[model samples]
Target: MKIWNEPYLETCCRAALHRLVLVGGGGRPDGLKDGPCLERLQGMGLARLRADGRYELTEAGRERHAGEILKLRKAG
Candidate 1:
């Protein structure tokens, strides 16, 4: 098995967050382990676990990506 690239965490986290917000949550990529994803996203200020296996967006985290999309939409 291969180790994950650090930058991929940001990208994956954004996609995962969007998926959660879009479809109301779902599964991870096959190779994306849950523990590390949670750790990475939490570190980046985008999410937190409520219970052992449950996660949700932090306010700063939600605004991080939401702010990005809002900027792009405004720019267009």
Candidate 2:
């Protein structure tokens, strides 16, 4: 049996994820120069391309941002 593991993002990729979240409402933000990092995030399903030719965070990405980036956790 194989166990699925969470993808590990490097510092650059994590920074890219943060940038996407900061953009919020969506529509490419200025100064987003991390193409490779964004591509890596896309491959991991953490971010996606918008119809307007911009990249945004997916639901999974938001959750990850909340948990990993913002360090927010659900109350147990």
Candidate 3:
């Protein structure tokens, strides 16, 4: 029942999901924006906090979000 898993991810906030999409797209968050979702993503190795205080998505994160996008498209 990991938060990054599809089931949990489906229930996560759109804002958090949007952040993941941004990170996956090579956009970095500029500050410490720690919260339950971000922390869980970090713990799951999906997102990471860089030494420069920016957040970037890991490769797995990109893949996951890609899959999510596909699912969203199909669901619509």
Best by TM-score: 2
CA lDDT, candidate 1, residue 35: 53
Q: Residues 5-61, candidate 2, lDDT per residue (tens digit)?
A: 778778888889988888887645433579888878888898887767788898899
Clashes of 1: 0
Clashing pairs in 2: none
Q: Ranking by TM-score, best first?
A: 2, 3, 1
How much is 32 displaced in model 2, in angstroms?
Answer: 4.4
Instruction: Give the TM-scores of the predictions, in the order they appear.
Output: 0.53, 0.76, 0.61
Residue-level lDDT of model 3, residues 1-76, one tens digit each, is 6466353553463356557675555555554444566656777777777777556777867776667765787899
Q: Which candidate is the best by lDDT?
A: 2
Write one digit per residue (lDDT tens) for candidate 1, span 1-76.
Answer: 9764434445555666665455334423333455565567777777766554566667866676576545656899
Alpha-carbon deviation at 8 in model 3, angstroms: 2.3
Worst 10 residues of 2 by lDDT: 67-76
Look at candidate 1 and tell me the lDDT of residue 11. Answer: 57
Give the whole-model CA lDDT for all candidates, comma-separated.
0.59, 0.78, 0.63
Predictions: Cα RMSD each: 8.8, 4.4, 4.7
